[model samples]
Target chain A: MSESLIPAETLERVGEVLSGPVTTVIDRREAQRYAYAVGDENPIYFDEVAAQAAGYRTLVAPPTYVTHAVVQPRTAADLRTDGLYREGTRIRLLVDRVMFGGEEWDFLEPVCVGDEITATVRLAAVDQKEGRKGPFVRQVRETTFVNQFGDEVARSRMIGIAR
Target chain B: MSTDTDTAAAAPDLATLEAGQELPPMHKFPDEAQLFLYSAASHNPHRIHYDREYARFEGHDDIIVHGPLQGAWLTQFVTDWAGPAARLLGVTWQNRASGLPGEELVFSGTVTSVDAETGVVELEIAEHTSDGRLLMPATARVRLPTT
Candidate 1:
């Protein structure tokens, strides 16, 4: 087995809320753009009557969109060398490369246009494990989305694999 | 007023829906334009998704499709088939391999379980290339409208 990829400080970050609670209103135009970009023109996203017919209060955002809905804007000066924006806080890690592992989402309530949504990201877990290639680190970032009514609308867990 | 899909079709009847049933497959043909639009819509500035040369520098075959885009497709696969009335409860997907541009990606699924009492249905789903390369393995749960 190789050396530990997760340091003591990093492992201790488990269950800590890493990013601040970002609140944003679900915008109709932005949500529609996302739906159109995905090529999913589900009428419930475009037609109000159709959304109500489907038991939603109004036009609905696509499933899993709540995570994207709350992304706070960043300035161009914050661009990283890789073209991705620099995050406010960086998680320390000892790894050569990190890869996107997977994502899990739970939609508890309908996320509709014009709804105010607040999201907070937590470092759910971090651990080093033995893989076929030797040793790697598995980290999970869990984000919870709550609506204006104080109802938890959705939750997402994004897994990152580093070696 | 863009052309809409048959997403407005009737929701599945929980009474008749059973385990072992197969969902009709959905196909996607993503191009550079689609990728650009998605990047803009999602506010992602990841160069691997846009700069082909940079992507190759990063050791990718080509400007590969975004993992989250494929994930969105997985949700679309279930929701489009289950119809607009079906409430998507949860979805999970693993990123296995990269999907390149112009590849015909197919999404297929089988009903893993069904709860008649609560109108809940579970599915085992996947996305594959036309040449049979597995890109993502996924699962989802949805609540259908009762009869």
Candidate 2:
């Protein structure tokens, strides 16, 4: 049997910490940019008047907008190089090729503009899989987002396939 | 406020949607520039998304689209049909195949179930190529307005 791509030591630390508890303020401009990037024409995400009509205090983010906060930096100059798959010691020790497998997100509440969102991320699980080409590792990172008031905004499970 | 009127006008009529109803299909042909914008907006610095040479070295014909980009399109699929009043409760999706840049991907969904009392509906959503190859298969739960 061929050896797995990820080391056993790395696999042993499945539940180890990967990134943050990183906090980011969800700006309306960023939200709109994300919406535009996805080609979403929803006025609630772009126009304040439309958002007000939708019963949001201000512009509401698109459903996947929270994802941007998951990867974005806290500040323009805060170069804290810590994130899932971002120069982390454990990630660096893993396999060579990495691909985004998929993800599942549950929205508990709408994340509106000006909401200070904090994300607590952890390496949830790791497993070795037999791919057609060779052996690969599947890593799942779970991130929980909350508002400044401590409201649970959303929970996500992102899976990455590395070989 | 006019927002209220617009909200009311934009709300999806829950009574009009039924189980097995197919939502309108959204066609997307994301080019390199659009993919770059998506990567930029999400702050993803993955080289495979931009550097064609690196992507080729990694064994892909062209730049690969971000999985989250597909997820975003699926979210739009539901929201566009449900309107602003509808709340997207959750979505679970898997990327079965790689989506190449400039490929015509069709996003579509089917109403699996609807609960009148809770005003929540379940949908089976998917993204496919123009020739009908499924790239991503997903399920979503959305809360619709009862009133």
Candidate 3:
């Protein structure tokens, strides 16, 4: 994790794009699937006809539907060998022994099916501190979602806790 | 009911709930079906969310719930308590543990502070197991109708 933690003086270097811009296309089927998963039956998310009647040009996604756009079809082996963890530790940051600290999302536009959205994720901030538990790393990641038209759709700030 | 109304009406418009005051509990038991739908929805294909075998390989006991799902449940719970017209000014949550299927997750909220003139309610909300294992803890500010 120390490798990913840029020095306080070099924090500006972290903003440089470190990887490819992954493009995720949100379709109507996926939108409805996410809506049903949360048990939210809002017609704007489920029925295309209803959504159109409600003034949406096409079926739009729920407010929090962007969580599904970043997962790529990859194996744990790939993540493990590829150094998924900044250093090389098998700490289940997103699953076990970790926590979803908080999130802040700003929606600038709506997402519909066939909209090829690209997420440009960059490491925003990383800090370490000593607490009652032990030493831990708090990483803040920022991802901006833009559609094929190059219009910014949404931006998310994700806080991850790794111990 | 008359006494209850009188007390509510006389409570200085913004009654601050004490620490022990009961904030009605909301029950949510997310089944595998719901999990699948959520996995499909979020586009998060982390095997731990759906594949029991993959989850086991990754050291999880079962398909774990999504962090956002827990947060959304809490948001919905608070919204329901605050009523439909109450606009959500802001919400923040910290996930301390993972919730699995069949666990009796309860959503509860309490008024931590209030602004009488502004008619805003500061809430200390939480989602936890029936056994009191906290899953998601959050704070929210909502504007309530003064009337």
lDDT of 1 by residue, A1-163 (tens): 5777777888887889989699999999999999999988889999999999989999999987777788788898998867898877667899958899999999999999999999999999888899888888888999999999999999999999988
Query: Which sections of candidate 3 miss by over 4 Å?
Result: A1-13, A18-20, A23-25, A48-58, A70-102, A107-116, A147-153, B1-25, B51-61, B78-90, B110-123, B140-147
| Candidate 2 local lDDT, B36-115, one digit each (tens) | 89988888766778888878887888888888888988887788778887889999999898889768888878999999
- Sliding window of 10 residues with minimal summed lDDT for model 3 chain B: B1-10
After superposition, candidate 1 runs with Cα above 4 Å error? A1-3, B1-10
- Pairs in steric clash, model 1: none
User: Which parts of model 2 have CA positions greater than 4 angstroms off?
Assistant: A1-12, A70-86, A91-97, A128-136, B1-12
Worst 10 residues of 2 chain A by lDDT: A77-86
Better of 1 and 2 by lDDT: 1
What proportion of the true contacts does each candidate reproduce?
Answer: 0.83, 0.71, 0.41
All models: lDDT?
A: 0.88, 0.81, 0.65
Chain A TM-score compared with the true chain A, each model in order: 0.96, 0.77, 0.71
Better model by lDDT: candidate 1 vs candidate 3: 1
Q: Is the docking of candidate 1 incorrect, acceptable, medium or high quality?
A: medium
The lDDT ranking, best first, is 1, 2, 3
- What value of lDDT does candidate 2 attain over all alpha carbons? 0.81
Complex DockQ per candidate = 0.64, 0.44, 0.26
Lowest summed-lDDT stretch of 10 residues in model 1 chain A?
A: A1-10
